[model samples]
Target: MHPPSVRSERLVSPTGRGYLQLESHPAGCFRGVELMRAQVPAPDAPPARRPTALVIGSSAGYGLASTITGLVRYGIDGVGIGWERAAGQRSASAGWYRTIAAATIARDLRSNFVFRNADAFADSTKSETLDLLEERFGGVDYLIYSVAAPRRTDPRTGITHQSVLKPLGEPHTTRNLEFADDGTALLRDVTVEPATEAEKAATVRVMGGEDWSRWVTALAGRGLLRDGFRTVALSYIGSPLTSAIYRAGTIGAAKEHLESTAVTLDALLAGFGGRALVSVNGAVISQALTAVPGIPLYVCLLRGVLGDRFPSPVEQSLQLWEQLTADRPDVDERGRIRLDRWELSAAVQATMAERWRSVTPATLTELADVPWFRTQFRALYGFDVPGVDYAVPVATDLPWPGSPAR
Candidate 1:
């Protein structure tokens, strides 16, 4: 039913020169999951109540980390929803392998874990997930919305919306990183034009809070929300260096919509003692960010400025869980969690800005953690993970062990 075992190799651009990785290594992906899970210490004591969670977009990046943290640290049962390709002629998506590894760990910990490899934006996917939650867990106590997509098809309207990364008022010119065929890093100035009104609207449709609201609405309509239910959506507000291209751009407009949705959802859930919040997370290397203009440069520079203090996706997710579960959750004036406080500290921003002004091809290595950035980028697709023997052949067509609706 699947392809034979093969030794996975790193594939790049069709022209053989670019930052895009075209293939995934299952072994490395499993190793990556293990590494992240290792960072979360087991709870000192069992939780007061074992909660059930539903993690949308829960296969990679912060979504995956949050899943692992919830399962391992809090002994939470979960249904993780992610859209990833199963292994075929090429390899399964890195997220596919990560889900398998996570499922294995959950089994060992005696936690009920279900993974659904289906479109999170579709009504069918939501219905199927809700069915599983109703059948197995009674209802969901926590909902984590961490979807990052280039486009989304509105299940209700049968219309598709694509997201764009462009500034609002004027074109933004910034230093960007380009990799040579030999993987040498090069600096170049790239100019990104402003998004049209239609494009801005499209971006909000794809990346904004509409889908999150829909999910919550669907769950509420199905009577699947447990008492004291809590929901969170991940967001980012970067430093001024990339603000024009990020926080002030089309994505920023979408984030504003997302934040406003949180306010509405909080009010909607008030009767159940539930809350909806947006956690402004720190910048971390993610597949979604790599595709965005100027984010790579900003993240690299941020890492260099923070050095060892830079928080990983898993670390930040663990901290987020602690805060959300606290008796008096720490939140800003807008009722948003601020996990980017370290990255946006005055001293960190000042140093990053100074380096940004003088950074060039010659000084990129000195001013930014280029090597770390590259490694992290590769790790997203299951490459360069420590202890993974790439020489060995791996079966790419592994199936989810106990998924009910895959």
Candidate 2:
């Protein structure tokens, strides 16, 4: 029988995606069923009228899901910007496969689609992306900024910044499960320390909306934005149990800035009827969120409330797009969309409260949806998807999404 555990290294930004395993379902599980359902767009969609868009930080999670939604659902003549590694001899990030799959589907449905594996925070990358938009599609009507990273090097200041997941003031004492190095559901509890003032500032520097503002201003100046262009970035505000580390922590500060920046950008975009809004999105399993300190165990606890019923990134993105496209889009008083309404509903919170009181290491496996959670986790990497034969040889080296000249 196939072993439950497989040796795998933790992926980090510095080394890129070379160490990623592409073999059996144990490697990444590209053969899962949910992935196929999400990737396959609704058929026979109406034609797009030269609709163009530019998406930043669009490799995985809500960003990648939004990319698929943009191409498949809206049939936008879209270009995606993300930092990704090529599907080399033995490895590639899940985003690479997702981009390929989405781009192929877009083409099949006669939707124009392209992607670039370049840093979105860099000025040079943005310039290159602008050129692609000019060459392929005259201008973009939508700018989707969904970047989530652990670190960012500021081009202007020449300062390297790293993000942290620690609480604001005091150390947040809670149960956390560190996964086994062999890539299994196996876990052990550990406590995370609080972050220093410097670390919090650094986290804000990397995760804040400053980079997002730069892109909007640059594009607006270059006349690359179409009339009524709308840009949205994702954020999260969930239960208070994880507040100390997530919502009220350094990342939360960053998200607050992100939301405020939207207000400023809205003014900047008013001239062209273009609007910028921050969508307080739900917690979805993705590369960046998975890497957060307290989020894993929080998700496991959340499983007790929302099991297989929990929404996927694709679902979240699609709902967001639909709401924004509606005749009267739903938005909060601050002019921001709340796509996470379901996650923070009264009923959900009630369940969360009940579960948090009784859940423990002993009852966690039984009370929580471990199998369902594991499957969802594996699905992020495009693994364990039904109908995908893991034993068969996969054509890893698909056509590159970059190459602005193309």
Candidate 1: Cα lDDT at 343: 89
| lDDT (tens digit, per residue) of candidate 2 on 1-406 | 1112223333321122312334322223323323543654673657547578788866677777777777767777778877766544444566765665556556666767777878887889888888878887878888888888889999998788999888877767765544444534544544678889999889888888999999998888788888888888888887777787788988998998899999999999989987898888887766676666656766777776776677777777888887656656689998889988877889887877777667776777766666666556666665645565456434444445433211
Q: Which residue runs of candidate 1 sit more than 4 Å off their true CA positions?
A: 1-17, 403-406
Model 1 C-alpha lDDT per residue in residues 79-169, reported as the tens digit of each score: 9999998767677788988888888788889998788889999999988888989999888889999999999999889999999999998
Query: Model 1 compared with the native: what TM-score?
Result: 0.95
List the RMSD of every prediction in angstroms.
2.9, 5.5
Predicted structure 1: lDDT? 0.86
